[model samples]
Target: MRASHNQHLIHEVLQWNGVIARRAHLDLSQTIGRMLRAGELVALLPGVYTWARWAGDPTVRLLAVAAWSPDAVVCRLAAARLTFWPEVDHGELDLAVSDRRCSAKGFRLHRRRLPPEHIVGWPLLGEDAATDGRGIVPITGPALTAVDLCAELGGEPIDRVLRSRQARLADLRGALECTAHRSGNRDRRRVLVESRAEPWSAAERKGHRLLFEAGIGGWFANFEVAVGGKTYYLDIAFPHLKLAVEIDGRFHEDDPDQFQSDRERQNAVQLAGWFVLRFTWYDLVDRPKVVIAQIRAALARCRKLAGIR
Candidate 1:
């Protein structure tokens, strides 16, 4: 094959996640071994090769692994990285394969075939978009990926996927049902059940649980509040009393910009007659009683001000 022809073949295979196998280019097969030896092409598997340029791209590596493993559907952290949250474990690759005999190096394989409804192409789908998995690398739907990772990540994935609007509560319930027969599923069920509040982050999830266990109701998670000309989403809000509970996660401590913006956001809400209470991970974890007490006190004070019976 000419150098240009070699580049063409490599680009072709890389784009498909190795969907177009080596045999499809038999006319250039005679030149492949030489190119591999010359370092112009890199072999992902015995029969899979891509241009040397893409050998280091993380996504290319993921696709190469998928191409190497027959019937591989990206799942778990890999699925989340591809869809809603990109900052997850970038190098961890997990795939689902129905083939009993399938295996791949450096990747975890779940040996169950997902139902068609449980898989979608990369970039994710809207809550109701239907698909036939044509012309794309398959990935477990956001709901299935969230439920699958619950045992490892708790309610975080469930919360994030729902917040992204790529999956519904029913979708998560259904995914849980699909995995109910598997062992070590109690955590999955617990996470999904706790996620009914649709908390946006793990800290918010924990905070919501604190309120739930204390029988604190009437608070909305990620409540939208419009003040002045801007909009803000309160981590947790009591609309009736105009009380906002802000969960300050790691970002609040590390990012000065976020800290500054939060101050501005709080100023706006407070000016609009809202009472705000802020809590950190330590407040929630190390002093649950104190957190609850503060919330109860705030509720009482707000009620006194609002003259609610």
Candidate 2:
């Protein structure tokens, strides 16, 4: 009966969090050994195991790494996924360890010293993470994660982190300074400087650069505007003149439903006392002069109507 009870307990851990930490179950050593020998489980790290089927899951690998080093902060691609970029996939678990930086089977450790401001306890995703047994894991903070990923991903992750509102421009600046000695940092610095406008998309970045070169100021990118019951985020907003620049990127071009949705959204914003100018990738790329002239004319008309000098 006692042996059967041990099996039941082990099964519960596998189903809930997808891995059983040997450190968390010292008393179940014999049972774990039996399970390993019988092929009921596969080792994820030095002391972490999960069902054979779940051994390949990224989250399971992360959990297994966390089990191996509870104090280690989740870093790199794993940190990106957890913090801002959920689209990151097929990466190994990377952890920042303050202690011995040992490379294990399923995960690797990064030897680094992170300040207290760069680590935070976040709920690690699991089968029942939102339920009563919410096991929070220590992970790298969003700004640090963004900076760390900049070496491989470059500027995109930083904008994504800002878009998520998890980290601010100041936070990213601080993180960039901390990692200045790292490779490709000159380009990273350039990207950081360009990040002042905080454009959230590639096309928005192009639009922002054009405006900057033309010496146009007082515009906010990805500005939040509450129109009616639905909250709308304008690609660019000049609040003083109530002018919005909508960048119709590739995502807005391919989807039929999204095209209709964008029109509906444009109509709603128009009704809310705002003038919107819609531009596409081709418009900005092919004839930027024309686009700029249109914007200047619109600005002049808006200022004239508002009686602003």
RMSD to truth, every model: 4.2, 3.1
| Model 1 residue pairs with clashes | none
Model 2 residue 147 distance off true place after TM-score fit, in angstroms:
2.2
184: Cα error in model 2, Å: 3.6
Best candidate (score: lDDT): 2
Q: List per-prediction Cα lDDT, in the order shown.
A: 0.78, 0.81
lDDT of 1 by residue, 1-309 (tens): 386787576566556443335675777676677777889787754466777786666656655654455577888888888887778874656777776454444566678867788887662222232253323568888888888888987777887888798888898889878766776589888787888888878889889999999999999988899999899989999999999999888556798897888889999999999999999988988999999999999999999999996
Which segments of model 1 are wrong by more than 4 Å? 1-20, 37-39, 62-70, 100-102, 123-135
Report the poorest 10 consecutive residues by lDDT, candidate 2. Answer: 126-135
Total clashing residue pairs per candidate?
0, 0
lDDT for residue 282 in candidate 2, whole number 0-100: 83
